[model samples]
Target: MNWYVVYTKPKWEKKVAERLNAIGVVAYCPLITKESQWSDRKKMVQVPLFNSYVFVQIEEKERNRIFEVVGAVRYLFWLGKPALVKDSEIEAIRSWLSVPETYEVAAEQWKKGDKIVLESGPFSSQSAVIQEVKKNHYVLILESLGCVLKVNKKEI
Candidate 1:
């Protein structure tokens, strides 16, 4: 079996993964936990690493079965075929999610005013400029959208 990417309804990655797994499909939806702060309290929440996408390992003959699951919209086709993801890439995602401390080291080198792209979370693939760097976090400006975001250091 090989891994293929599936497009899902917005904010439905977790649901699709769960449904696929319930049907005996090996599904993966990478997630990261981040602390969200409000005026009075802070709490950690699990958020999907990639929005609207899930990975499933299955034989080609099982494609129809996967598509029948609700929230699973379509395959991420490349050159007229479903794109295959290598095991190494999936393993890398697993490793990254498993270790939360490694993010500090990876994020330490970015300087102020540096151009950064969000690889995960709600802003996945969105470009932003680093406005300020604080301990384990960054103040970023999404110039295109005229919005400011405070993101975990590791997530940028």
Candidate 2:
């Protein structure tokens, strides 16, 4: 068996998967829920990670029969031949993106114009507003203005 990419109409991946399954064609569509908020309201919706694409697992002989399905517009290929995506790679990404793992990102401080100074560190002499703070050290967004920069814990 091999996997082939199928391009479906917009927002129709689930529908295509359902159709394929009913016809005994194996299909995989990984979905994720995303939240969006605006001044009016907030909504949570399910969206496919790979837009307009669905992966189908099928026998070599079923190729022609599967192609006739509606919304199974075309196969993703390279050099005029269908490209097969490894199941291991797909599974790896699925596991990696899963929320079971724990990760912590420290909060950021200081805007572009805010004054900053490193209270105690090798970079003490330099001062800059916290453009962005990663594991440690501020990006110094306003370094161009040349202000007295101090990267204190409070301004980090």
Worst 10 residues of 2 by lDDT: 147-156
Each model's lDDT? 0.85, 0.67
Superposition TM-score, candidate 1 onto the true structure: 0.63
Number of the top-ranking candidate, with TM-score as the measure: 1
Top of the candidates by lDDT: 1
Off by over 4 Å in 1: 37-41, 102-156
Q: In candidate 2, residue 152 scores what lDDT? A: 28
Model 2, position 136, has a per-residue lDDT of: 47
Task: For candidate 2, report its TM-score.
Answer: 0.61
